[model samples]
Target: MNQDPLQNLRLSHPAHFLALGFGSGLSPVAPGTMGTLVTLPLVWLLAFSGQTGYLLVTLLACVAGVWICGRTARDMGVHDHGAIVWDEVAGMLLTMIAVPVNWLTLLVGFLLFRMLDIFKPWPISYLDKHVHGGAGIMADDILAGVVACGLLHLLIFIGWLPVPAL
Candidate 1:
């Protein structure tokens, strides 16, 4: 019997690619970390589209991703497993909003978002543990995005970051 822990997210499935974070979730080790890294390039490219486009795309992805992730997880028979990383993709996209399309800001946002995501501070942690189904899978990342947005603003306010040119 084949005993791979997370097989439902097949690369052949388009939903899997979107939900598993463009195949980053397929990494044998540290899939969550890999998912975040995989998103950096996409995020960087999207950042060039300006704040409006960035926000719209991220919002759309998040709204659609919940279902894709939920159904894919159910198909794979795993519940919010690390390999299902659409939430990370959507959250990372959200973090790019209103931030400069530069390496420094990307690095900062990536580090901060990943930290909040993994640590699941306060209400974020609460949501992750309590919510069920796709909402549960997506909620924690949404909170992380909120925290990242706040931090990005703070960094800009302190002159540590530059406002993106629309």
Candidate 2:
């Protein structure tokens, strides 16, 4: 525990500026997952506004998160360290894309996102291990979100999953 997470992860690097995710990576507990979880309130609140707001925010995060995550990672000198989790936040937000504003849908989306993220299958795993800097850390999670979102969308399209009441 004496090894500071920031020091060990090297979050001070200038290039990884965005990877720090506004310092969300500094959280004590499972920083990455927690950082991702931190967005739940905002996501839930915006859910009522329809998918447009959520979509807009998620998209914005995705675009911005890349730079943030990349900068922070470079500054820290760590390659895709767990502390850098803005990718998870963006990915989770992406997973919820098009999802109706409801507890059930949110819960399902969260589960799916977490599951896919943890698994990091196929392209996600490849990018996670192969890519470098902020793109490495965030890209894989974002891809995971894409996969989860596609699955969710497919379920909805086929009538397997009903849209929740907003």
Candidate 3:
């Protein structure tokens, strides 16, 4: 079985490329955070088109990520390998759905999403443990994104994080 996933970086398979976050997942440390950071600029650009467009793109990315992550994980003979970070990218996108395109909001969203993803609170933890396959790998982070989204919105609602006027 293929255990060394680093070999995927050399192969030009689209799924591998995407699942690896276009090489951001190669980081020796905190690859998930790196993948999420890599998503910031893309999310910023997507935000230019407004929330509906961003939501549409994020939904599409999540759908595509299921296949990409699953194939990459299968090739590596593992489930949710550390290097498969397309889930992070998709999750970050989902997290920013309600956030305004401000650096502070982005940073806060990043931190919150990372925390929720790592800590795996409540149902997020439950799903992370119980879910299987690509969907399983993606579900926890997606829910993390949801939690982060709620927190960011709550902060905004309470005047803790200012929402820049669009």
Best by lDDT: 3
Q: What ranges in model 1 sit over 4 Å off?
A: 162-166
Per-residue C-alpha lDDT of model 3 across residues 30-134, encoded as one tens digit per residue: 999999999999989998998788989999989888888888888887899998899999989988996777899999999999999988899999999999899
Per residue, candidate 1 scores C-alpha lDDT tens digits across 20-132 of: 88888878897887888898998888877877887888888889888988888888787887889889888888877777767888888899889999899999999998998
Q: What is the C-alpha RMSD of each candidate to the true structure, in Å?
A: 2.0, 3.7, 1.7
lDDT for predicted candidate 3 compared with the true structure: 0.89
Flag the better candidate by TM-score, 2 or 3: 3
Candidate 3: the clashing residue pairs are none
lDDT of 2 by residue, 1-166 (tens): 3544366344455434345555676777777777667767777887777777778888888887777777665655556667777887888788877776566666777778888888877878898788876567678888988988898888777888887543
Q: Which candidate number maximizes TM-score? A: 3
Report how far off residue 27 is in candidate 2 (Å).
4.1
Residue ranges of candidate 2 with Cα displaced over 4 Å = 1-24
Q: In model 1, how large is the Cα lDDT of residue 95? A: 77
**Residue 166 in candidate 3 has what lDDT?**
58
